[model samples]
Target chain A: MAIIFSSLNIAFSQNNDQGQLSGNFSVDAQVYKEDLDIGAEVPVEKMGLNSYANFLYTRGNFTAGIRYEGYMNAMLGFDSRYDGVGIPYRFITYRNDNLEITVGNFYEQFGSGLIFRSYEDKSLGIDNAIDGLRIKLNPYKGVYLKGFTGKQRSFFDFGPGIVRGMDGELFINEIFETLNNAKSQFILGGSFVSKYQKDEHVTLNLPENIGAFAGRFTFMRGGFNLSGEYAYKYADPHPDDPSGLYNYNTKFGDVILLNTTYSAKGLGVYLSVKRVDNMSFRSDINATLNDLQINYIPGITKTHTYSLASMYPYASQPNGEIGLQAEVIYNFSKGTALGGKYGTNVSVNFSRVNSLEVKPTANLDRFETEYFAIGDELYFQDFNIKVHKKINSKWKADVSYLNIIYNKDVIQGLAGYGTIYSNVGIVDVTYKLKPRHTLRMEVQALFTKQDHGDWSMGLLEYTIAPKWFINVSDQYNHGNSEKKNHYYNIAAGYKKGANRIQLGYGRQRAGIVCVGGICRNVPASSGFNISITSSF
Target chain B: MKKFIVVILFLSIGISLFSQSKNVPNVHIKNLNGEIVNAPDLFDGESLVILSFWATWCKPCIKELDAYNENIVDWAEETGVKLFAISVDNARSMSRVAPFVNGRGWENLDFYLDANEDFKRAMNVINVPHTLLLDGNGKILWQHTSYAEGDEYELYEAIKEQSAK
Candidate 1:
């Protein structure tokens, strides 16, 4: 640990004009303790640590970078395959005259990322960067093109497949002078991605080459905007038993997504609808649990901030699902009747997802489903409303309410348990005691008759200007008398410039943790933790 | 480990011996119109630029932006400073950013979307609500991570001081 800190410190302090040396480092370590009351099982090491450092250098039109990651025994929720230390990512790029070329590992996305997106999310323990070559060309003023050929990263190595893709985008307003100042702007884009794997399986034949294509369009006029994408995939078959996400079947896949938004001075409205059927595209047919994924299907649901409200978050089902989401935001003037002195902002959102209605065909490996029909199986539904108001110079508050209908059996892949209906409410208040001192308090309550019954949580945080902060929070499950557990935590941190250090100790509840709709399960545990982050 | 430290030190010392100009990298981002714009080009070399990296799902980010929105009018008029809010929302929640910002009545501020976090990586930012202050020449003057209630005042003071210089 000292060695890591010392190296990072040296890198942070060194600065010169020959070229810019900029990098960032972070270290997160935890010490586990035994607590049988929460069904916590200690690991063999009894400690876990995750650390990463990124060094990026840029000179003229050239940039190079590398990321070093180490997971000492891995964390509770993270995959155990990342148990070693190595430099898993490295890339070099050069840009000039509207042409950019990159070699090594890089992340790329085409259009809305429905059919092809390569990215890295540390929180989700996902990094599917492609290792090969990528090129971007802007031949004309309004035309942009991208092409790449690479292999997906798979935990310290590369997947057993070769992926290639090409994308083109055109901005109509810029292409023709006649539409330069048009109120209605138009943009069109398309992408084609394919993966190649070996055919080494017996008893069943597989198409060694599987390809997916996507097309998207955007229309905008003043305050109204509309965008949509349609994608189709060739027959991709994988053999996995009854326990995997993709069963042993051979079928084509397709998806369509539509979204629209309208906004004015103080009002905004958004609506989105999507349908997905057998669209799970992966570089490796045998990989599971967020491994070697070649495409991304966005979850069309609101991501709640409150702990209880997010207790039963929705995860995108790529195999087959129909989802719709709508939201409205309105702000009243400062002196209006409902706006009070400081005005009020209110937003209402609702989202629902259901399984795709499919009927078996004469072929055992294929099923048929209508494009717009929804299945009877309910996957997840959430309706939430939030209001934010500033009472005075020193007082501000935010209140939110959420009603959720979660199908645990489907979302969490469990059995026996049916749907879990829950209602949650939260109130957060902030008070400025003095010039540089502020305090915030939040109280949340969740009521439900299923699952773990009901839950309540409270948190208090105090901060002093741009330096120090302390917070204490507790979540209590009082609805279950048989096993009432209290998950309490206390932490403090200090921040200066681009550096922050935080230390905490608490009992963690076992549940699904998600970031941007990607999720992973974490086991309950008790531990002391510390994290340090700094960038130069 | 000792050998690794030696190599890193050698590289740092060797690299520090050279010199070059410093300026914001020209990273491509998208405006509300879905057209690509060079992020560094926004700095016109005449006014202070404040770039705030935020996401729709983050709470403190909203609070910080709201605080700035209240006083940005006065600040801009007085010091000729500009504020640009960059949303790092991925595809899952990118569509809501526009509505969320307009709903909060923050239309006065310029908004850009870094859907793939290209600008974020170039700046070496780790978390949302990370604020950076750039001079007229696009050189980074000051930066801070996280936000509290009164942090905006400090930023405003920094702006005043730098503009005076």
Candidate 2:
């Protein structure tokens, strides 16, 4: 080990003509008690720590680096196989001109990460780094091609499967360089990917060849832009349902995104609709959670940052779901009746998702269909409107209302009763007392007859910029069939340069934590918490 | 009926207590190969130990290990440390552990396995590629939840402070 370290130093010094080396490290530790009854099945009752270090030496186009990770006690809601110390990613890749190649662990995403997304989410305990060879070729001005073959990362090991993929994209404006200054700019691309695994079957016959293809086109012309992608996957069967009853055959998923903006003034409007079916593409048909995931499905719902607003976030059902969302933003002219002195911003958004209705036939299975029709009933719906205005030179105000209909039994696979209808209203106000001091207050109320019932919340925040901030909030479920639940939290944070410390004492309710498009169920608890992060 | 009610009450309270959050348990155990040995002893004053939890079948884990093997020497010299690469391979494949490490030529890392999962459970490990950094006194100073290619530089900076301290 000592010899290896010496050699590395010498090599880095020799390669780095400037003789400079840099690295960084971080640690995430959590301590809490577990409630075994109504919470998640698995819980961590002790202090868990996960840490890692990274070192990189770069000189020009060449870059080299390695990382060491140590999981003293892994956190709950994570896979247990991550409790070792080792380097998970290392490589030295160089780029000269338009051709670049890398051999080792690397993360890549293809086209909005719909069909393929190999990345890392530290907090979620997901790292799907591909270990193999990757090559990128730019033969001409507007054409690019990428090819790679590797195995998907599974916990501390690799899945018993291999993946190979190739993608090509052409920029229309670049292809016709003379059209660069044209009124319309366009781009088009296509990609194909396939995964292979040995099949040992006896009862049912399954296709060993599984392939997926996608093509995208985008056009922009003066405040108007449109983009669309059509993706399809071949037939694939799993052993879990050997009868091919719940399997997917010849599945197809497509997304069409249209964006237009007239920034000449102060107003913006965006609308989009997407329909997907049987696209839960995975490397291993049997793998679940942080396993051999081969593709990603985007959730069409808005991500709420507030505690109560995020309570009922929707998770994308990859198998079959139809989503529609439309949003409009308008800013009134300043010093007008609706705008006030600083002007007013108003936004309205509506989104709804429903399950794909399917009718079973005597001779044909459900999986054989390419497009499943929508059911008669709706699965989920949300309509919200928000208004933000600067009331005065030292004061600002925001108000919003949301109406939602959520189906617990269908959406969340939890054993429950009927649908829930909720109406929520929020009012927020902020006052600037001084240059570095500000105070904010929020009041919210939720009225519902199903699930947890009616609720009320209040939050206060005090901030001293570049130094400290404190927040206190409480949520009370005053109306419910069962027991009334009350949740409260008080947190303070201090920041200096690149270092920050946060401490909080609070009682929280059980809910789902969703990042990107993935979701995890987090239980409820009351405890004191502290976290410190610093970088030098 | 009374016993059943008590059980229900206990379960309900337990669920309610942890209904909103999860707890990661902590335990003390030894990383055993063919013999039993305490893990704390491995961290001497000379160098900080980078304990990474991984398995032979996990490709990402292997990628991380291979990455470390390729740059183990440089990391050691830059931060003056060593890596304690432990495998969470169960008893069924425990015998295959040493050979896999040898094949990778991971000489800079001391190979060990927690076949029984006692060490894993004690460490509250929920996933692979989990890592921890322990000071010479065996106290955990810094840690990270996951790994990326450039994350090692951040880890090295953390260790340099502890080593200097």
Candidate 3:
């Protein structure tokens, strides 16, 4: 790599005391063509890249890091076994005053991660880092502990299963000191993950040590808050299962979650609920899709950054479902009456999902559920609303509305597209035009009569603040009765201080591209792109 | 590839034989009532701080935190500086970040939540309307990563040039 960046640029100009060396870099390339009326395809390395870089190095308490990823032939729905790359991730750590340790690759989450969570999300190309030991402790003064035993990356190699976990938490008023002036507060946690693969199936006889467990809690006071978690696992069946939608059923799985919140001064509210069943904890259980996902099913809806209201999004199925979501927001102060003169927010959201009642037993490979029932098929629903406003000082706006239904045969398993209602609307605006210039506009539509029925989009942007920007967009389907493609794009960008670069030309629309609710499946092309980012 | 060049020449010779450190690296975020909090105890060595690193479906990180919530109370009564904002919003949008920051009233910015980004990978933030500018013992005297529209007046002139040193 160019002699390791000229020996780290000559040890970064003879170093500033040798340790701190922050990191960050990104790349994204594309060049494809060959559009056959939107069924775009053209690979054979017609051009595609996806690079990454991370270098980290601290000092006090010691730290070390490395990450370099490349996917010269893996973009356009990623996963080409990530073509080529190395340095999957590296790490080393050491801490003090309360102990901390790490030994190679990491990323973790326990409490609300359901059972466990190892992270990374280069826009849904997921990382799932976790390669060896990890430890964290505080020993008291509010307690907190963690442990690990990794093996889960599966792309640049690793993932034949061998994961272990542990977690702990507590903070009932920072471990009682007269409850720290108590005003209602508490936290509690617990977790225990497990895995170990090696059953090389040959007539079924699995369960090579699988385990899972969870518990969580939280509660606050002023302005209310709540939290919850639950988990359980044991029977995980796989052997030759690649999204055959799980069927070697040995059952035993579970999940549950809850969330709540409330606010004051200008309103705010939230709610969440989940159920999942047969959790689908992967770590190579014949991993599939955003692979090796050892927990993370959140997605109770409401994550739509509009683009035709995120076109029927709401993955989070994890085998079985049962969801919920709610939101509020408000605001509206500046001179009341739906707040105007620069104060008017709004919000309002809703969500739903279903299916999870289960039935059938008597030794047919296990099947029984009912605890917290709720099923009748209908996997997804949404309702949205937004407002946001600011008039003077150069105008601002953002209107919104959504109402999806989706269930395209249980979320894209597509089969005669069962339910697919839709209804979207948007309108953005900006306009500053001077103080460093700016202008923006957007208008969207999405009504539907069923699969690929109606759609419309538009955008226009211009900026010149801290750097520059340019945008152009289009998206039409105009109630396609057969075919009515029209997905255009034009982009430009520039930024300094931390660097950034962008360029584009496009027409790419093949669906499913999520992050957070995790998803991926971008196909359809006609491109020319470039992106770059940096940090130091 | 030769074990990746001997693991990059043994981590660049153990990063040129280590030695350097500053503030902001205790990582462990969560405020907004979820508690936790411990990112260098929100710097206090003497003043001037400003984190950022946003999310909630980033839109220029809600327009650079709504322009620092419209001038963070005259920049914290003229130079007390503070601004936090964190929020990497994982777990699928982290329960809509406290009703999207109280429906965008932004209540004078302070939110937190790094959900699994672990203080955004211990401050090497990979993207999300970044922004930093510590001082008060935490070092980092200026950082930026994306966000336009008058970039908050050059981050309040780099916090009034580091609070006039």
Full-model lDDT for every candidate: 0.89, 0.64, 0.83
Interface RMSD of 3: 13.7
Taking all chains together, each candidate's TM-score versus the true structure is 0.95, 0.71, 0.33
What would the per-residue lDDT of candidate 1 be over residues A476-497, giving only the tens digit for each residue? 9999768999999999999998
**Candidate 2 residues B1-165, lDDT tens each?**
667666755654564444221111111222322323455456665577777887754544754675576566887887778888778654223333444454334556777776544344334344566666766544455665434333455566677887788
How far in Å is the alpha carbon of B155 misplaced in model 3?
A: 0.6
Model 1 misplacement above 4 A: A1-17, A243-246, B1-22
Better of 1 and 3 by DockQ: 1
CAPRI grade of model 1? acceptable
DockQ of each: 0.47, 0.01, 0.25
TM-score of chain A of each: 0.96, 0.89, 0.32
The DockQ leader among the candidates is 1
Q: Candidate 2, residues A325-368: lDDT per residue as tens digits?
A: 66666767578899877667676778898877654556443443
**CA error at residue A196 for candidate 2, angstroms:** 1.3
How much does candidate 2 score in TM-score?
0.71
In angstroms, give how far residue B132 of model 1 lies from its true place. 1.0
